[model samples]
Target: MVMIDMRDIQLDEDESEDQYEKLLRRAKTEDLTEISGIGCLYQCGVDRLGRPVIVFIGKWFPATKINLEKALLYVIHLMDPIVNGDYVIVYFHTLTSNNNYPSFTWLREVYNILPYKYKKHLKHFYVVHPTFWTKMMTWWFTTFMAPAIKEKVHNFPGIEYLYPDIPPQQLEIPAYITEYDMTINGIRYFEPDQSQNLLS
Candidate 1:
């Protein structure tokens, strides 16, 4: 039998508590006006299965202009309450230019720092209008680093595919995403009147 250092364990526990407190402070105090204005992340509503639906609009995120640390804090603030139960993420990748994408290192760091509780209750991760790069990057990351969530990740070429799992009526989808979907897929996911209204 080996001897365990109680002092070391206590120090680690204290460090974790301190870190959590710091994150809570930052989440409460950080100025996330720009991020909020762009509407990069929000809870649209609940899915058919009664899971909370968290939407992340990729095109709205200005990675270069925004402070990533504050953005991460804002994410924690928005998600902390929702993650306690089962939820699903709908990532709209429509019209996402290269500049909108965050750095791989930053993405990795955010993933690493996120508490396991956040990862545990995520039932599904839907990527709508996924590009080639998005698919490849997700494949690489999930396969190499996060194998547990690999099966939970689903890629959709258009919003129509997502409608089966999450009805269009349930989500407050951005108009631009629907327009882009129509442009590429040559089809509308919403009803005729709804599609017309979205375009109007």
Candidate 2:
């Protein structure tokens, strides 16, 4: 029989989650403002599917790829205590387009270099509001991913479609996503005359 460390497991799941959350709330980066753009928000609860959800905004990424990677890694490290079991990463790339999007090469490199433990528990990857170029880029880049990884990807053209899978309140849907969704549905407060203003 194999030996196991009972101390490694926390009996009180809520207490463990609370501890992880405290760390995340206290987590600081070199650039505080940038944290809003690329940092993880709340982690107290799971998604609608009962899996831990890590929410990240794609457009908030720094222009420098290295900085972006570092910020993300730092955030993940802070949440390391709770990022086990079946976790689902809900990425809001609604505002990300070719102009601001990272190079496909960098994306491919990140995927190839992801740690095994990180890859194992990733149950789902939900990409919301994918642009035309985003779709094209994903199609091309996914060619390099294994079938299992590829199956985890799910694209959302509209937030309405995403609600069934992930509740709005559960994910704490960002204002920008809600705004974008409103614009998509011909509901916008600004420039009322231009009813069809959609963010790219």
TM per candidate comes to 0.83, 0.65
Q: List candidate 2 stretches off by more than 4 Å.
A: 1-44, 186-200
Per-residue lDDT tens digits of candidate 1, residues 43-154?
A: 9878768888899999888998888887888898889888889899999988889889888899877776676777799888889888889999999999987776898898
What's model 2's TM-score?
Answer: 0.65
lDDT of each: 0.81, 0.60
Model 1, poorest ten-residue lDDT window? 191-200
How close to the true structure is residue 108 of candidate 1, measured as C-alpha lDDT?
77
**Top-scoring candidate (lDDT):** 1
Listed per candidate, the RMSD to the true structure in angstroms reads: 6.4, 10.7
